[model samples]
Target: MSSIEGRHPDRNLINMPMKQNLVKEKHDASLHLISRDFETCIDVCQKALHVLSSTVDLQQASDHQEEMEEFIVIIVQAYAELDRWQEVLPCITQHYSGIENVSPNVLKVCLLLHAKVQEFSTCSALYNIWTSSREGREVNDSDLEMLLDIYVTQTLLQAGKSSQITEVVQSSQLSQDTKERLIATYSELVRETQLAEETASTTALPDLAHPQNIVDRVVAKGLRALRMMLMWIWSVRPRLSTRTLYSLGGLATLLIIATQGFDTSNRTLEILGNLMEHFIRSKR
Candidate 1:
């Protein structure tokens, strides 16, 4: 009984000073955080962490785990406020899972930080967890708008990665506002991509029959435009209207007249023959 009692008191004596120092350190750290002295807060936390490491007692470490976790949360906020997003990633990945109940505000900031760094996948997972957390916080318009804007600004606007956001759109329980914004974004992208495709597949031609186009373009861009028109007709023959077919007759005649001595006889004849075949098929 005497020996056991002696050991317990000795252990308490050894652990007690560290406990007092930890409390003081945390108090100072809290003050630093409140004052926006972020770097100093981190420094105080690190110092306390070193003390915990030196103790190396599993029970002691477990007892103070909550304190350390709080410190890490502050550090994460500090990093985010400083715009050191890359650093926030490792801190979150390391400390986040160990936390039993995460603060919604902090998690929201994490999501936003991931977005700032273009970490789309990471941002998505954090967003799902934050919005779906057991805390039962209602997702406000600002939250929904933030996620949508993240996709629009980072993914679609920058890399044209609309396909990447499809899974999020389908899986997430979005608000009507978000859905509407997504619809608008989708329309914008479709208009843009369609325009790009048209530009690539056809030469931009004003009406060749127009007096101005005939003047400005006939010599400068006429032959190029005619070849594009012929290719366009050939490509869309199955869906061609009679008017478009007649339109092609004009293009074919122009092409033959323009390129007669340009060493393109075989190809020109092939195009003319294809047009004749199409006319015969239409008549039949």
Candidate 2:
């Protein structure tokens, strides 16, 4: 069945309210659709989009500029869920340019969705707009930093390009905290890659009769070592200012510890060890 039949018919009808009631009703209707039938969700979303598009219509006698800006956000969110990222990008770009009184919440949502679809070029363009705008000065939200970091990291890893990654790390605009997190993530990836290479070079089979050859022993040792190091670092993280250097040292230490002991606990250890073994085999 179509999702629209489940939604309230009246909610789809838009009327101009001089006060904030128009935006509130629209928000409420959108939320209602979310809680009910998924199909009905689309109808409410399209209605919100219609409200936004019509406000700018030349035929309209009065332009409700602020209300239109508010409704655009609702539409953007709906398009995101449908994975119509292409549609969202233009709407966001237009809003970013045309709206003088746009909120940070709106800009944040646009940036986040743009990042999710791997529209790095568009994100760069929007970033330029945001940085130059007077409103841009207040864009201190962490979500934006996280989205950009993830996009840049994934793009670099997939393309096997380190120069751009290094550039981003050295860039003065990125906060020290975000830079440190990215460095740690990158370091972990490098360690995993090296471990994979080492495993590929070794072909000697471990004796099953030997306790160390048992799956549980290896995983237990790895997890215990990892947990201890993670706890120690997390505890010290607040006090440390040299995040990138500290994270590199911590990961190196953890890698060393992971290679040391192999004491088994239960089936969980066996499962993890078997998983690692499978990973090793697949790499070959």
- On lDDT, the leading prediction is 1
TM-score of every candidate relative to the true structure: 0.36, 0.41
The residue pairs in collision within model 2 are: 3-39, 3-40, 216-269, 216-270
Where does candidate 2 stray beyond 4 Å? 1-20, 32-73, 98-144, 153-155, 158-162, 175-185, 190-284
> Over the stretch 98-200, how does candidate 2's per-residue lDDT look in tens digits?
4233455565566567766766666556544554464335555464465455545545544445446656554525678877877777777766766876887
**Model 1 agreement with the true structure over 221-255: per-residue lDDT tens digits:** 44455556655665677566667667666665666
Top model number, TM-score: 2
Global lDDT of model 1: 0.59
Number of colliding residue pairs in model 2: 4
Can you tell me which runs of candidate 1 are displaced by over 4 Å? 1-39, 44-74, 80-90, 93-104, 128-142, 189-284
